[model samples]
Target: MKKISILALMMVFGVVANADTLENVKKQGFMKCGVSTGLTGFAEMGADKKWTGLDVDTCRAVAAAVFGDINKVKIVPLTAKERFTALQSGEIDMLARNTTWTQSRDTSLGVNFAGVNYYDGQGFLVSKKSGIKGAKELDGASVCITAGTTTEMNLADYFKTNNMKYKPISYDTADQVQKGFEAGRCDLITSDASQLYSLRTKMKDPSAYFVLPEIISKEPLGPVVRQGDDVWFNIVKWSLNALVTAEEFGVTQKNVDSLAKSSKNPEIRRLLGVEGKMGENLKLDAKWAYNIIKQIGNYGESFERNVGKGSLLKIGRGVNALWSKGGILYSPPFR
Candidate 1:
């Protein structure tokens, strides 16, 4: 019985250790994605049993690039504590959760962040009754934070650097932390500003909990994949770039086909596969990016539909805007 258990574990590890995510995804005819259990605007399911969110679109865009079909994906809902393990174990091809890309995670976790999809920052959500007007007011407050995350370190660093002291109440899941906050287990909850808005919408009275205006730490959140597969990594990276690049080139789902035929801009023409074999460079179809934009729209479109003014979150683009504007969403040229 002991040997059987060991043998099973070894087999699982062997598969994970040897499998090529790109080939596996191609063979399976669909991409496997890990996502938040249920974070509004980032990753969530609706009444129609269909998944929709900004991160979900990331998965769809990748699928469209691979199969020319955006719907060919399987979303695996995972908790904050389980997301990394699932990705490392080859249980999922990529994680499109609202996960922050940090130095420790990038260097130590055997995972590589493709690119920043949303540039966020840490903030606090305090109940209105607490009357915590600013970060300075919470000197000894008990902050609710999720476990197995970079938040713990940031929380300690922020308080220490500011010469403030606080207690921490940690949980394994976002839902647990939010529940603890709602039940009055902590004085405040600290996480990415975007998540604070997402959690606000889940509150019994969202109006009662407002995020503090103090931005504490930078949180560049994006998709992640295993580290060893360069092909899979580039595919995921460029799929996201496809969205941002499409937006920059004035190509969108509604107009990409037209632009592919009529656009006079050399970059746009090459990007839309009218002149160069951009997709061939990635070992995919020439229409790879065209399919992504035509199916998933651009990054801006996904943002508006899932979390921006167009969605219930009502969050602003802020630092997520294109680099040509004010924000820093810049993508490399297809060349």
Candidate 2:
């Protein structure tokens, strides 16, 4: 008998070689998603002890795509310092903890950012009694900041670039920073504007503190997953795209079922897996996108309900709005 070629053997076993994170997730009966410790409107446990927020929704969206069940996910709360390590060590399948996409993190860390879920900037949160209306006024003031975040560097850059001097107070968590600020450990706290708002709401008197007008740095926040697994990366990436695309085409949780069944628009049809092999391409069920919309919601809905107008955070869309609506939130074509 003739010896079989190595290429022929590989061809016969290609499926096994291609097995990746998705298979592991499915075998575990759920996806392990890393999230913030407890940032309201992003990834905080409600009074009922259920995880709910924009970041949590992103994790749920991916779960809906992979397992067609929103509840098929285990939330792994992590601090900034521990987040990347969790992903790198395979402790979590994906991370949706409002992490910023920066050069060093993107290149050095063994992870890839799926996409920008929230466009934010660094800002100051100060007590109204201080009468400090802007960030520049806090020149010599000590600043409370969260450790192991991009905000630390941005804070130093902002102060130095403005020819200012200040003392730094670093805490291991956002909760600590909040307490430090309340205890007068620092004159003010600084972080991504969205987090500043979230922290403000948790303050002793929410109305007494306000985010400063000046935005010191661009912070494109999004989900992250380990590098070297294109299949898993694409699934995470497109899960987000599905949400944004649904919003762009006016699809919502309230209307997804109807549209998936009867919509004539080609893009909507493809997105809903009513037409085209969109789900097949991702190794998912035909109703993957539909499950996301039906159970979790579109990006706009998630934003509004968690951090935007519909919630206590009340953050404006700003750059997070859909591109057609005059902000920069745009998704790639589903095709």
Q: Against the true structure, whose lDDT is highest?
A: 2
Model 2 per-residue lDDT tens digits across residues 1-335: 99875534643665322338998898899999999999989999988889999999999999999999999999999999999877876779999998999999999776899998899899998899999987778889999998899999998888889999999999988899999999999999989999999998889899999888899899999999877789899999999999999999999999998898899999999999889999999889999999999998899999999998999999889889999999999899988
Consecutive 10-residue window with the lowest summed lDDT within model 1:
1-10
Per-candidate clashes, comma-separated? 0, 0
Our model 2 lands, by Cα RMSD against the true structure, at 6.8
Q: How accurate locally is residue 199 in candidate 2, as Cα lDDT from 0 to 100?
A: 94
User: Where in model 2 is the C-alpha error above 4 Å?
Assistant: 1-19
Give the CA lDDT, 0 to 100, for residue 315 in model 1: 91
TM-score of 2: 0.94
Tell me the deviation in Å of residue 85 in model 1: 1.2
Cα lDDT, model 2, residue 328: 98
List, residue by residue over 243-303, the lDDT tens digit for candidate 1. Answer: 9999888788899988888889998888788888888888888888889999988999999
